[model samples]
Target chain A: MKFGILVNEGPYTHEASDTAYQFTKAALEKGHEIVRVFFYHDGVNNGTRLTTPPQDERNIVKRWGELADQHKLDMVVCVAAAQRRGIVDTDEAKRHGKDADNIAPGFHISGLGQLIDAGIKADRLVVFGD
Target chain B: MLHTVNKSPFERNTLESCLRHAKKGSAVLLIEDGVYGALKGTTVSGKVSEAMKSVTVYALQPDIEARGVQNRVLDGIKLVDYGGFVDLVTEHNATQSWL
Candidate 1:
């Protein structure tokens, strides 16, 4: 099955993002396809390039990056939400006249329409949040 | 239609209203604190429409784990990841958030 994911939870505070990774791995193992991973609200943090965790904790941002690299899946961060939350790509930082960009590589900043579109194309729309 | 459930079951506000309004073939997804609804026999959980057996009821697995209620989920509900959630929005005619 083709899957589209909606992640609304942040990495550090919630397990939603981590669970998303597990689901993606499970789907791939099951021979299912991941159409896209849409990050919204606090979930946008998953695309930030500035994440740094303690040695004792898991590096979730890197984990997501690895997943995208291995699967070649689309990782979409909501531009509006990302910017509002201080997560900016080069273009967004330049547009807003910010000092720096925090969006990581392998992640695209797109509109919510991509999420809606993914839903239309995917056989299953899974949501991980809280 | 798409219904979003907020964390609280007792609030009887937007989330409750959405649940009450959900029609057949609709979907109800629990996010954030709303995952608590996965409990088997709560009064709020009991209100879910068993009649609409095809209606998809899902809980964010991450939220379920965060709240330490992963094992408490009932059998009928589907544990969805982010991608599956997006598919729901696409499959449905409209999506509504209750919180």
Candidate 2:
């Protein structure tokens, strides 16, 4: 089955990110295909590489980066949400006249159309949020 | 359809509203604070039990454990781990999260 995951919350503050990560990992382990992972609302924070979690804590952003790398996942952060939360990719940074890009590896900033496309293409659309 | 609710029934009406919109044969998976609705003998359990007549119900085991409600879950609610969560999504045609 092909799945599309929608995450609507940020890391650490909520369990949504953790649960989404676990579900995504389990889906891949079970040999299911993940069509896309769409980050919206506060979830765009997960795409930023600037987070500095405590040494003892799990780096949720880095964990997502690793997972995306291993699976070659399509991790998309909503452009509107990212702009509101300051999660800028190289193009967005340049467009917005920002000094640098903060988007993490294996993630891209895209429009909400990607989310609509995921819904249309994937067999299931699973959402994780508050 | 698989309708997932992650809010506490006491704190939010997500579970109640989800039940209202769930079609016959749809499944409801309670996670996070939403697991509270699956607790046996709770006021909300009555409604959940009623909804069970037309829909299958599930609760995430880890979330129940985290909230210290493992022993209180109602009998009919199936418990699932993260892998089971994936299975549920696969079994269903689509998922709608009541966030």
Chain A TM per candidate, in order of listing: 0.96, 0.98
Report the lDDT tens digits of candidate 1 across residue range B1-99.
777675667554545676667777888888766777667767766665452375778887767887788877878888886566655655776666665
- Top DockQ: which candidate number? 2
**Which lDDT tens digits does candidate 1 get at residues A45-83?**
898878889989988888888888988989999988887
| Separate DockQ for every predicted complex | 0.13, 0.85
Give per-residue CA lDDT, model 2, range A34-74, as digits (tens). Answer: 99999999999998888999999999999999999999999
State each model's TM-score restricted to chain B: 0.84, 0.97
The best candidate by TM-score is 2
Task: Supply the TM-score for candidate 2.
Answer: 0.95
Worst 10-residue lDDT window, candidate 1 chain A: A14-23
RMSD of each: 4.9, 1.3
TM-score of each: 0.65, 0.95
Runs of candidate 2 with Cα error greater than 4 angstroms are: none
